[model samples]
Target: MPYALPLPLAPSWWSRLLARVPVRERRPRLRVVAAPHGGGTAPPTLTELYLARRLDMVRLALFLVDDLPTAEDVVQDAFAAVCRAYGTSLDGLQDPGAYLHTAVVNAARSVLRRRRTARAYVPPHPGAGAPVDEGLLLAEEHRDVLDALAELTRRQREVLVLRYWSELTEEQIARTLGLSRGTVKSTASRALDALERKLAKRTETGR
Candidate 1:
């Protein structure tokens, strides 16, 4: 086996619908074996770690990114990256869980950069059978906020999204983006200020 990235596995009707493109016939170079800290031995390999954490990651990415297809793309990319770095202790990845989490977050930001028209947050779908009020989530006020976020520059939007949505510390965001903590804080505060101004303008206009 060549240790390639795992194929996306979706257990949803939507997934089947979207995945009609046909899975390739190629075999994986990397195969995930069951973890055995006490069950056996050998630290979890890249694939094993990914399989253990895939569902949560997929869910988080979908929520953060709104678009299901894009979420899969982001995760797949991140997984491939993790695999690529598995050589030589994988950047001291002593904590695979943390590494994957960070990778997913960074991937989500990358997706936002590509789909520049997307809002700051994607509202959850009521149709997905998850019990949440989609209408309330997508209310006029919230819509205005997302629209305003979309209007801002990508860097500002990214900093805010990572800080607020991903719940990443300033230091984490800085490391992920290869930026200084001061820069991350400055961008986030500036973004928040701009969003506030826009929201105030919108509220005043409505009144």
Candidate 2:
């Protein structure tokens, strides 16, 4: 009679372990165990991770990119990149959540870069018509704020958006943008001042 090896733990066991841990402690760290009958060990897949964090990722991307469809595309591309780079198993990734966040941010940046390039290549005609942005859907009160937001430089805008919209701490923003905490603080301060000045100017002009 042939002896059979013990089957590996089910994915639910890993999910339970994850649920018990605090959010900050929930890093990817599953071991691969060889199956009894098969080629090799199958590590945990990204499916659970996707299901758990997809909505939050989409929101984050939306804040960065400012369009729902573009945000969705950015998130989908981020997940696809992660899968391609790490495989469906997400093996060897220490923090897949962080990886996804960074990927989405980078993708959003790329979209902005392309927009800037396209704008430079195509000069606007006098009173040229343009497509309405979805930002118009925001309340009238918010339009002023968004207009002021658009006046800020890209780096300033990113710092403000990540700080306020995403509510990430200075340290978190520093790590995400690969900048020093001091830089993040200074940039945020300057961005806020710039926004206040823009809003003030807008109010004065309206009166």
In lDDT terms, which candidate is top? 2
Evaluate residue 169 in candidate 1 and report its C-alpha lDDT on the 0 to 100 scale: 76
Per-residue CA lDDT of model 2 for 103-148, tens digit only, reads 8788888988887888899995553322254332222334456567
Clashing pairs in 2: none
Q: What's the TM-score of each model vs. the native?
A: 0.52, 0.65
Assess the local accuracy of residue 119 in candidate 1 as a C-alpha lDDT between 0 and 100: 44
Q: Which runs of model 1 end up more than 4 angstroms from their true locations? A: 1-66, 87-92, 105-141, 205-207
Give RMSD (Å) of candidate 1 vs. truth. 13.7
- Backbone clashes per model, in order? 5, 0
Stretches of candidate 2 off by over 4 Å are 1-45, 124-141, 204-207
> lDDT of each structure?
0.59, 0.65
Specify the poorest-scoring 10-residue window by lDDT in model 2: 1-10
